[model samples]
Target: GESVGLHLPTLSVQEGDNSIINCAYSNSASDYFIWYKQESGKGPQFIIDIRSNMDKRQGQRVTVLLNKTVKHLSLQIAATQPGDSAVYFCAETQGRAAGNKLTFGGGTRVLVKP
Candidate 1:
């Protein structure tokens, strides 16, 4: 499914140090990817993105690595902080009219230690 937003609400923990969330897309033609960080009670905010032509993209504290071969993506955040605590979402978009149009991945709730 393309451009699906938080159709469901949920939350959990970060455990000792790390956690991994997974997503499956229904479209095979989508060409770009983005990860967004939305704090509690706030709208989603952009974190990072990678195009179909690329396999990985990195940011200051985040990395968006894409596996076009499998239509898979993952984000890495270094030094998870309490401020980093939020609902994280990944999105994919096709490069055409309404190209800016986006479909978001199911979100993950991340908790940080004090």
Candidate 2:
């Protein structure tokens, strides 16, 4: 399972510290990978994506690193802010030629202590 996270889904910070969230994927058949952030009571918002052909991707103050060798992925938020608090989910997409379907992993939560 690429769903590696601590329960309680929270980080008590001073509102200006950087935060690191982690995940572990279990599918070897997966190809395209993406990270999404979901705020309270809202749907996930696209963050960044990395392909199996790549190892790392970055956007704004966020950086996503992928280690396909270990089937692991991580998201790093710089200068974590109160608005960054939300649940994060790592999704693995491998087109199912049989039915054209996509798969997703469980999500992780991030709590910003502002």
Candidate 3:
């Protein structure tokens, strides 16, 4: 089984500032990683993703970075806003095959301050 965990339990970002969230995974075999944002009472929403072959990936004001050597993953949010406040999680999947389950991290709460 794979284990994922965030470096911090919470992150505070000033409005309009950038926020970086870090995560580490135990399984070196995991090839795919995803970053998800979960608002209060809502399910996780996909933010960005990166494959083991890629070092970095960007999507709409967000970036995902993968470091397979250290089994580390990170998500960056640009110009953090109040709406960006949520619990962020990093998930890893070992295979590309269908039905592969994602191993999610404990999650880090991002607080946006005005």
Q: Best candidate per TM-score, number?
A: 3
- Give one digit per residue, the lDDT tens place, for model 3 in 1-114: 222223548898999999999999988889999999887767789888788999999999999888888889999899999999888999999888886999998899898999
Query: After superposition, which runs of candidate 2 have C-alpha atoms over 4 Å from their true positions?
Result: 1-8, 95-100
RMSD (CA, Å), each prediction: 5.1, 5.0, 5.0
Query: Candidate 1, residues 1-114: lDDT per residue as tens digits?
Result: 233335544444453444454555557888877888887566779887788888777788677777766778887776566677777888888885654889987777666766
lDDT pick, better of 1 and 3: 3
Stretches off by above 4 angstroms in model 3 are 1-8
Error of 2 at 30 (Å): 1.0
Clash pairs, candidate 2, are 2-24, 2-25
TM-score of 1: 0.77
Q: What C-alpha lDDT, on a 0 to 100 scale, does residue 104 get in candidate 1?
A: 83
Instruction: List per-prediction Cα lDDT, in the order shown.
Output: 0.71, 0.78, 0.88
What lDDT, from 0 to 1, does candidate 1 have?
0.71
